[model samples]
Target chain A: MSERVVAAAEEGQVVELRRSGRRPRAVANGVRAAAILVALVVLAVFPLVFSNPAVTTIAFFTLVFMTSTTAWNGFAGYSGYIPLGHAVFFGTGAYTLAIVAQDLHMPGGYGVFWLVPLAGAAALVVAIPFGLIALRTRRHTFVVITIAIFFIFQLLSFNLGITQGSSGIQTPTPPWFGGAFNIPFYYVGAVILVLSIAVSWFIRRSRFGLQTLAIRDDEDRARGLGVQVGRVKLVGYVISAIPVGMVGALYAYFIGQIFPQSAFDPLFDITIALMAFLGGLGTVSGPLLGALVLEPLQQYFTVSDPSYYLIAYGALFLIVILALPRGVVPTVGAWIGNRRARRAAPSPAAAGEASGGAPGGTRYAATVRSGE
Target chain B: MALLEMEDVRKSFGGLQALSACSLEVEEGSIAGLIGPNGSGKTTLFNIVTGYERIREGAVRFRGTAITNSTPERVFALGIGRTFQLTRIFTRLSVVENMLVATQRHEGWLRSVLRPAGSASEHRRAMELLDFVGIARLADAPAGTLSYGQRKLLDLACVLVADPSVILLDEPAGGINPTLIGLLAQRIRELNRQGKTFLIVEHNMEFVMSLCHRVTVMDFGKTIVSGPPDVVRSDRRVLDAYLGTEEADGDEAP
Candidate 1:
């Protein structure tokens, strides 16, 4: 009932549809949310029960990728600015954590975990200048600029004295032992993941988020409508950097090394962008879903057969993207929405067939738009 | 009192001059019409007023304060709103979202981002405007699904949501059916009666002549005449400009 059909049929007054559809959709959304909560709870205890180093390691990296991808989506998804060099902030956070931990003379273990949020703060600072410069451009140019800036950071990390270059700065090891060692990182990563999702959820519904979406759709129009397009884009870009930066710091602690190669991975940007694209570019659940499916499979395949993993992974990505060009969440969402709309309507054909030849882009957009 | 004034504005694109020396004034609480041949710089003038373009030599004033070279959103914040020659509503946003984003009327700057996209009052107001425009039932649907006329209506509604004191509408009657055009004219008259100001750029002379309090005619990037609609309608210069420009004011769907 909550499904608002995009049918342009003037057959009858549509005012009644809004009244009937509201409550049912709300209940359905609540139920779906509850189910996801239960699933997240069950997934959180995975490392505790499995305790296998290999398994827990995969779980930990999955959480990291999920968090980073979702954070990336916060800006790129809404703003349509694909920042291919997000690792600039990611690297900055890693270096910041390493430098701060050393200068503070802090002991290793759970204490370093407290600095994860600090890592996010550091990323925010770097992002402001990066965003100011990069957000001025549009579309593919913006992507190219981000990639260019990324290389600059990568070079700095290699050449900078404080970063320790090839020697690689070391993070103090966790004082724990055995298979249980990965457990702490896994849980902490999980916590970061939850926090990132909560933040993302808020932004999706916020007025800022709507403005960002407007920017994505039409920057000039958004500007004419009184949106501070530049400010909104910059804020989205900066906000996206926080989780990635924090994840990078957490990653450094887990690996016990802050090598430029590991911390400022060029592949990192591609992977997160691909993940978000595969699941859904702008929707909240799309990135999380994409990360969940892709990251673990990526980790497992790399471990099981490193050579064939890339080939197989590449094949899968191509197939999914080609089959669902709009991405899985949106494609599937449109189908579900169409189905429900048909059910809700008095006449079956008016819901879908009547809206036939409505452009595919419009259907996808209709499915993704948060009507409430 | 002059609500918006542009003085001897000159704008050029590369070698061609779009606005040679165009000047205009819109009085408070009056509906003003800007009509010109195609490429006669009507839209360019609107662009400069909304801060989308920077004039080579000109001063734009809103309420006697210079606003030259200000940003577009800043211009809007200063109580001027504009619509495009081609309707530019966000295609992916819901019809209501199109209205709500213009609710910068609610927040001053970046503060609105922290608030929920729709408050009870804001949603109520958005829905009311949508209903006023006769698209209230379509509010929950993505705006892309709207027909061309509907999108034009939505564009106007989006601008009105900001409650700007002055609105610049470029071709509000273009491409829509005559019925919808009449509805649009009626709405504009009603809004103007309530003390809102309008600066409309239109090729539909009948709509402009019937609806506008004053008409400003442009030819070759210059304001040839400005006066009551009936006076400008029969002016020899206005007649020559239209005939010389291949009768560009004819019904040409943009």
Candidate 2:
């Protein structure tokens, strides 16, 4: 009567065992807070802890690489648009700072620092039209378009007399502030890394993040659900470009020079992309973790044998892709989550009691119900 | 006046003529059904009204505002929400996260980045809808893992979280179990009682007959008959449209 057995069976298994919320917000928040505290402590004392000029230099580069990769991951990783030529923005930022400072005869140190944001702004502006055109085509097409743009910029820098042709422009070093200039540059790089990470964290939990993920999952469905796909992508592109641009400006200043080949290096894009993929594509900290691991490895390889470094890099990438296809963070997270779920599963007697139904009757009824 | 109105809407994909001179209306608080044999432009009409596809001929008005060629987001903002024939939930996201995405609006771009995903009230409403759909327990489960029937329910819940005045459901009973179909019907009736207007395109005759306040039958992208289910079910033209497709090929006389 009134589908009594059906109701009992549903209560017995599915309804009885089901947990409403699984996010574990409190525990996650605590863990995140603790991790942030530990990271900040380590970062603050890093220069002091290492006390080696070579180590500090490498650490500075690591921070710069982490900032750029994290910024790239914010949009490309989240939206599933592999930007093959993201170096466009990075190069643009470097070149903009170089051109402006040279053309304007700007003084070094704080005077030039004032225009760093302008470099970032220039890259952001450039990304708008480029993103609009490139995002019109998706997946592989978009990747190709980005690569085309990057190479075009590279060729322009090499040929344009305004950019000093192939010889490149020599940047003025910033006014030294107490000891080696690299110390201040290191701290600045660290600050940029922290800012980029914060931006990534913010976007990952924001409404904008949800829309991007929706687009990544299915563009048509996202549009159908009232997400302005074109506009969201453009905004995300601009945001992503801003940090990379700032980093480029910093890098140009740090090295006291900007060359067409180095400023617009295609390897920058490839390396950052590889870093993001190696860690976890969509996770906020993935790119940072990736940069930490891969940048040091690259540095070591480059010092040992610069010519064969790239071959080794390629081999390492293939190994990661073949062995851990889902990347480290997600693969490990999924494994731990599955184990936890198994341990959390209720026993049969406990499940029956929780269901508030006759054990034997509901168990038999549940078997029949599941057969459908 | 009808809550939603389509006046002589016509659409064509090159030469196929997906919809031709189609017109229908859904009154306030009524469950209106659109049915056809296979492809009589039922979905086409729904697409036109929801702004998924453009209408070549006529106008679509919602609450007396002409929204003939409005974008899907504009249509949704105007309180018209819809679900696809095939369920289109964001597969990688959790069920609650999917619901939150649907509840989002196109506001300030910077604000979206600055603010968190959904307000407390929005979260409450999303959870309530999930509960109403009987899938609250699966709120954190990735949507891809859900059964086809459960995905369908989640799809409906996503639309409901928007709290639209009018909902367009394309094939609400397609490929679902009978028990779930009955539950779906009950939910529709309950929502209708609360003054939510629905325009549903369903192939299941029994489900439509039991749930729809009135039914419209279409043949060859034209409305063949429109009335109460019993009347449309027994109409000569309707029967011919469903049973003998060849006989109803030519244009009907005015």
Candidate 3:
């Protein structure tokens, strides 16, 4: 009878079932959540036992890439803005920190830290004008506009000595952490990763997030429904730039080097875009998963033959686009949900009859039996 | 005085004269109907009056205010809510969410960002509107998942949520099942009795004749007749414009 009631509700029959006051489903959900939490906690603290500096450094780079991918995914996946020019923001952040540390001769770590967020702000300023122009066009045209803007920025950076043209700026290592291997950097990167996750979580649950989803589904209809489409898209674009910019600055500082060619590299944009797309768009954990899985492979390629890295990346992008268009999370989520539903035994109709036969079937049972 | 008046409204799309010096008036708190054959400028007049399309030459006055060249958003803010011929419901959003988007509120973007969705009043009002439109049961369901008739009801619910003084329904019964058409008529009459004015464009002559207090007939961008439904239905010009040469042949046969 309970199964029948659930089935009726699924079919939209409007069956008002009596409350049993039993909390089995709640208990099950709690247990599932706690298990996941425990698993995460174990993973977070597990590295302490290994104590390898090389592994810690690689993990730090993975976290930074994860942050960039998460922010990029939010805009491109949910909002449906194909931002081919994210490198503009990323490059800006890298150059901003590089210039501040090298030319300005500011105090090492703290100076670069304060300047990093400023780079994000500067990237936001650039994004505003770019968004205004790009958002005026639709779909493929918008993509072209973003790509063109990035190319323009790349060419200008190459011509101007402000960013050291092709040679690039040398980022100064912090005086205090100069000799230390990797633990402090690992902690900092982990914190940034947590912060990125929190920001992504906030965005997904916010009113802005809902509006972006509506805009993505149908812009003209969204407009008719009173959504300020242009303003919403612009805000999303600007918000997406912040983390990418900050990560770029951190990358420059970590490597103790920066160059126009390296800072504005198309590979940076393609890799982040590929990570976000492959993991899934519009999902909070997708980019993180993409970064975690793909970054290691990318590191391997860099070590093996750096020149052929683009070919491998390009092939992976093609495979992801063709196979998992909805992204990994939603596709896998739907499959798991379907599998669980299929495993539940004894058809609801049969259960309804079995229960209805019991002692003049209760009023609620009659409603459920009627399938109304 | 007319609550909404259009004087010599002329609108043209390049060579096509959609509204050739058309004129009409809608009295306050009355259910008015606009009807004609296909391409008779019924929708064009609605577009011009509601500020969706620009008029080449005309004056549109609403409550003694000139709204000739106002934007659609401005016209909506000025108390004119409209539904499209194609039922423009936000498909991916829930039925309640669709209505919520249209609710009258002072919360700008900044306030919406800061506040976790406002008081229960807005939500309660949205639920009331949904119930009024007979879609309360489907309130939580996605609007796109609704049947065609249900989507039409949702569109009406969204318009009603705005609490507009006057509503311009492009077609309240277009492509709707007969049973749903009856329900739509009843709802329109109920709202009209409650002092809400409506200007509806409908192709269903039977439904229009039964529900509309006054009917305006147009042809080739001009008003052919305007009077009570019975009188306008019998007008020679309306018949000629609607039936063409068949009107004369039918007169002799029947």
Candidate 4:
């Protein structure tokens, strides 16, 4: 039966080659690598080309949100956890960096910069117990537990004397970057964004990632299939926390202060969820695309009209959820794939699929009948 | 000594007892069938042995090591594989990917990340297993696209991928056509001849009587009889257990 598929392919007819989706083409890989290289070069020269502090600041904020959103998507989107408390790690990172710089009285240069990863480590360590406890609860309960944890951390920041009783911790400047430290910070944000993308890509291709998707699809079946469900989830949560924490540490250094309100802000969680969902949850590029589109719109709205942006944000989320639940990338991706399949072999297989007559065509009808 | 043994195993859900002091043994290199009417606790016993359910009192021993409270993954790691009655295959994954995920060998997270799911050897093995189940053409298909009988074959192939010492199949022939049932029976016999032990929960008495080396009957969460198929088939206690049940028809023919 497949020999005929090969014959059709040889005659330049589309055979619907593989059942799941299109195979990864070498040309696509090349195109992707070139795109990343070009993006890196452009970002590397961004601060140099535009000396405007406002431009650099906007870029920094965009990158920061991008990093955090991608990190949140790593575990939550992929595993269908939908965490509403990633601010826990972000705030932890911010406070940890602030406390370390203040108490240790560390001078900048590489000395203070070296402590950034330690801040991330702090978040990762904290996430272990928190993730284990939170992940025990399924979807809705998990979201509530995460919110509870976020609030607990926020309250801790407010009451703890070491956090300066919510007045905020003033961060020390890195001594190496002479003037306009925002440029160096922009570069830091870019590096973190790249790392986020890299980690996301790695997870998407890994066996660990497959296990996560299986858990997302059906947790009990994943366990029955021999996946250590809890352990894998904790690992995902911990991996997610590290990047958010690192970005938080960098944000604190850029802003030069940390407070319970800003650091543990629920708005951050909202933005992360919106960004990931907007781009395409579970896809590696989804969160990145989402962050790029929404963050600048959000910043523009906040600058122009603060009250309206919140309303717009809520409205936009509702629209996306209602209309394009799979997000932009996957929806558009599937459309393009179907178009190509139709163009390649305009009538045969597609007609069979529509009519539910071909060998594997029943799936399409089942999908429609099931309304999933 | 048995390869898999459950001694006085007890399990309850809320106020309802599911398994009441159920004792059973599956010896090495033998095919055993667990036949019972609906709600007879056959699945509960399988769940308990596979660590999906915990036994209240009594021990489940795999190769002589007590593994009563082990997690599902832990039990799988200990070389006891199982299939679900409702077919728990990863529907979103490709058929080959589903097989690959069940590979018993553990890979470090870093290694897994660096190595793509399309490694040559794993792909070959996955394809081999898919072909072994007579669905090699569907290897690249999303498992959700498979027909019901094809999904059952995929489920069986998944358990076999781990190469475990003992496999517990929950209704391998239920809802399958006669042709596929014959194919499945042949495959089970072929695997058993190769020294793989099987404990099957089935309502198809013909399939059980013809393929199983031994058959055990259960009713109301209690083991009624365990012996050669002919002995168990003619036993008065076993007959009474199925007297008013739908399964009486299955026993009557064979």
Candidate 5:
């Protein structure tokens, strides 16, 4: 009886040791949540701190790209369908806001914000037909189809009389000017980005997102298991379109002008894809991280050297492709995962997975593997 | 009574005739076995019943309902589940998550999106099935890290989540070791004793002969002979089909 008590005491110590090992990781999670809280507080008061118009303007575009890139991830990342033509929806949103503002002759101010959701709805409506045609194709063909649809939209905007035909449409300039002028733009951009991120977060947690990830991993197998893959793709596409359209509407008001070429810019598609890929595709936080890091640099370069800016971006993208093929966020995520796995279990294979630095980057990144 | 039927199923790819008037019937409460040489249209028949490929001229019925040309999701919802020959588990998903994916067909996408991910009962069912298949310890690990044999086990567990009346396992014992094969066979027996029906396509003759109540043999896209395992074991036609000819030069049936 005494010996059994001693054995029980020893077992308690071992259990306590295991529990203590897990405590630090739990503490690490607490630290991460604290970091996010601090970041949110900093972002909330950024415009007040900087106050410079140029800085506010840069912050505004950064938020816009972040929103749109996240929206793109909601579909393209989850579905493993890289679209080379999301400009179609962005252009549609811009035009919707423009036409509505014109038809009502409403003096554009805070009142215009009411129509922002209208612009989002309009873009969503347009996405249905676009998705119907494009989703029937697979992988690389889907990319080509998106490009074709984007070009068609650009051509229509170039010739349509209401779009001003090779000229442009301009929004009413805000009565406010200077640093104060960009305050609304920055905050509005921030608000939409937060909403987009929330929507994406829910999607990542939902069953629909699981099916989408399954489709991304192996569409045929997903179908065999009873996932309605086509329907999931369509819903994801529309879910992705709303925030993008909202961002496009905000962009039109900020620039005070909308051009067919600029509104339907082909680079919009490439830039967002780059942003998502540069951080980590198919992740909740990846596109946001990418846009935050890259957009300010991009804007600064465009302001300083417009002619040579894209070349610099091209070189940077090449280096990213070679150095961290899965992108920074996923690589870092994998490294963390490896550490956690080692801490939990000293398995030999975990070390190799850490060094390989590619496979099992994250659950999200694992789904968006190299496509057929 | 037939739980699943592929009657006079005919399919072709380009100029090659893959399934020339193939027909198969699986009984309601028995473990039915299908054995055939490679490229003899066994997998093709599975594809047709699951609605991955449109039937050129055939009909599939499940529990007296005509389901020809139904979608794969429709087939699964109507109480049939399948696993691929290559073991297509979602490599990125955790093993338990992979099992839960099979439980989603009943919920429409919107309803599924609005609700919480898995109910307490649903998660309990998933874990019980994982334990039943001996993968409960690996439930939190990504499915990709599983060995080839373990992946095959995971695929079986994934299909069993829906508790479909009929299961079509393509190559359940194709490349796994004897130990896993024994475990898989034992699990199938356990499930079969519970009244679940299985339609298995396997190349392991010994496993089929030992496990199946009834066995069907196919060659060149047509059923040659089908009967009890002992009868098929002694049949001359089974020999002719496997060895390509009645040979006296130390040749044997596969």
Candidate 6:
């Protein structure tokens, strides 16, 4: 019976090992499409289900955090350029919107809704010069420089008084949205969150995405192969900054205030980086997973035991990094893939024969030959 | 006229002179071999010409255009493609994706944003390159999973995708299996037939002699010899450099 099963598997006939009749390539693509569809559906329905005022408020905050984290993930996870001071972009967007809305008195929602993206554009403009200097340095050095930029901007915001100095500005809520503290704001936040995720997903599969992966894997090799490493990375940094800026603007409107310390918080940067790392650095679903899993823990900590929460979050990060360096998604994905591969096979010999007959079989044979 | 010329190129790393006035010329459409013992500055010369290392006191001219101190991207844009001694592939990407990266396309941030979902031409071209290298079956396989030989072929395919006029292959068959070496030799010949100029740095005498039309030998950051394969093989200096005194005597006896 085992022999018959093995023969059938090798022959590509009726076998338990066959996951689907569709090609493996098609199946993998199908899985990705389904995941995107599911995420879109969830985002659309989230605000309706959580009708409570408090729940809506928390959801809004979560969405903002998600947007910033997703943007951070694009550079840190995909391109391997760790921006330790990403709060600069976030703060820039927030302040730009704040100054325009509060001091200049740009129509209320115009500042929160429209000007936020404009702030993102300003961040992009800043990113060009910053990238030229920052990207020239190595990874750790770039991180340090990014951190310094954050400090510099934070100091500027405090001293200039344009952003209301240390006291910060009080942004007005748009009248159409029924003030900052409303359920409708939750829907707006959801839109931003969904848009951020969609744009990130789009970039990940695009030609630029391929180039970024190439750059991440080996910058020198990518350059040698005709990839414009500097330009590619600069664009990635700029794109990442936009969403972060939008999130900051939203945060300011939601709370009706913006402080230098709050806007340029190191904790927010660390949280986004930690969330991205915890979920899976290079996977599309990583940021979302990280946010979804950790945000609740954060809320619980803030409510139940605020003091211990910091320690808990830090410890969790350390534990996750030490235990699963590839982040949760990749580690779990690999585990599931391996498990499937194992369970589908009755014995090692049968499995070998089946694999030897598969599409990767010839390459495997070539690899073995090269090994010798 | 020489298609590419390096005139007394000099490079130093702090106290060590990596290239001491090293100079050589590669004629258009010719397969030029650069051979030297370990730490003999062959790679330094390649690096200087390819713009990876700066030349301190010499000029590098390609097709009568000065390219000394140019960036690697500029060099690549000028139709010079190179492969490393140890293959450097985009490990996580599919084989086809690796090839697509080498193809020239409008890659600005805006263009990427507005670019269509699927690129049939790019895909077809990448597949054609893969087929040329005999790795079409592995087109969808992640490059990291490929064997060393396959990776070498993929690397070659990537360079070819750039549609370069000149290719610098650093030790193409350095650590490959004997079977793959034969394949590499055949491919090099096939590519040469298509009018692509090659500057190869290899240690395998048999492979080098069989593939290269002319050989340029280097030692101690200077050109030791430059001639056709037969002339180079018979040169006493070539024998002395490759075999040393004791080994030269062994070869002389045989």
Best by lDDT: 1
- Indicate which candidate wins on TM-score: 1
Candidate 1 residue runs with Cα over 4 Å from true position: A6-23, A348-366, A369-372, B106-110, B245-254
Ten-residue segment with the worst summed lDDT in candidate 4 chain B?
B104-113
* Cα DockQ of the candidate 1 complex: 0.53
Tens-place lDDT per residue, model 5, A177-241, is 76599888888888898889888878877788878878887888888788988899999988898
For each of the candidates, give the backbone clash count: 2, 0, 1, 0, 0, 0
Candidate 4's residue-wise lDDT over B28-142, tens digit each? 9999999988999999999988888876699999888899988988888777889999988877666777887777346565565566655687778878887787888767656
Which of 1 and 4 is ahead in TM-score? 1
The ten-residue window of minimal lDDT in model 2 chain B covers: B245-254
Clashing pairs for model 6 are none
Worst 10 residues of 6 chain B by lDDT: B109-118
Error of 5 at A361 (Å): 10
lDDT of 3 at B227: 99
Better of 4 and 6 by TM-score: 4
Q: Tens digit of lDDT per residue, candidate 1, span A268-308?
A: 99889889889888888888888999888888888788898
Locate the minimum summed-lDDT window of 10 residues in model 1 chain A: A10-19
Q: What DockQ does candidate 4 score?
A: 0.38
lDDT tens digits by residue: candidate 2, B1-254: 88999989889999898887888988999999999979899888878887788766899999878999888877887789999998899877777889988777647667877889888998899999999988887675566656688889999999888889999999989998888998999999999999999999999999999899899999999987899999998998887887774535544533
Return the top candidate by DockQ.
Answer: 1
Which model is ahead, 2 or 3, in terms of lDDT?
2
Write candidate 2's Cα lDDT for A155-254 as tens digits: 9989988889888887766778444556777887788889888888788889999889888888877776778888889999889998899889888888
lDDT of 1 by residue, B1-254 (tens): 59999999999999998888888999999999999889899998988989889876989999999999898988988889888888999988878989999987547445766788888998999999999988897786677767788888899999988899999999999988888899999999999998899999999999999999999999999999999999999998998888853455454525
* TM values, all candidates: 0.94, 0.89, 0.85, 0.90, 0.92, 0.89
Q: What DockQ class does candidate 1 belong to?
A: medium
TM-score of 4: 0.90
- Please provide, for model 6 over A1-372, each residue's C-alpha lDDT reduced to its tens digit, 9 standing for 90 to 100: 011111223121212223234465476678868977987887777667766666666667778778788888887777888898788888888887788776566666543577767787877877778777888886889899888887888899889957779988888766665233465566667777878777787887777877887888789888887778888898888888888887777777777888999998988888988888898886667777888878877887898889998999889889988997767777666554444554656687877766534434333222212111
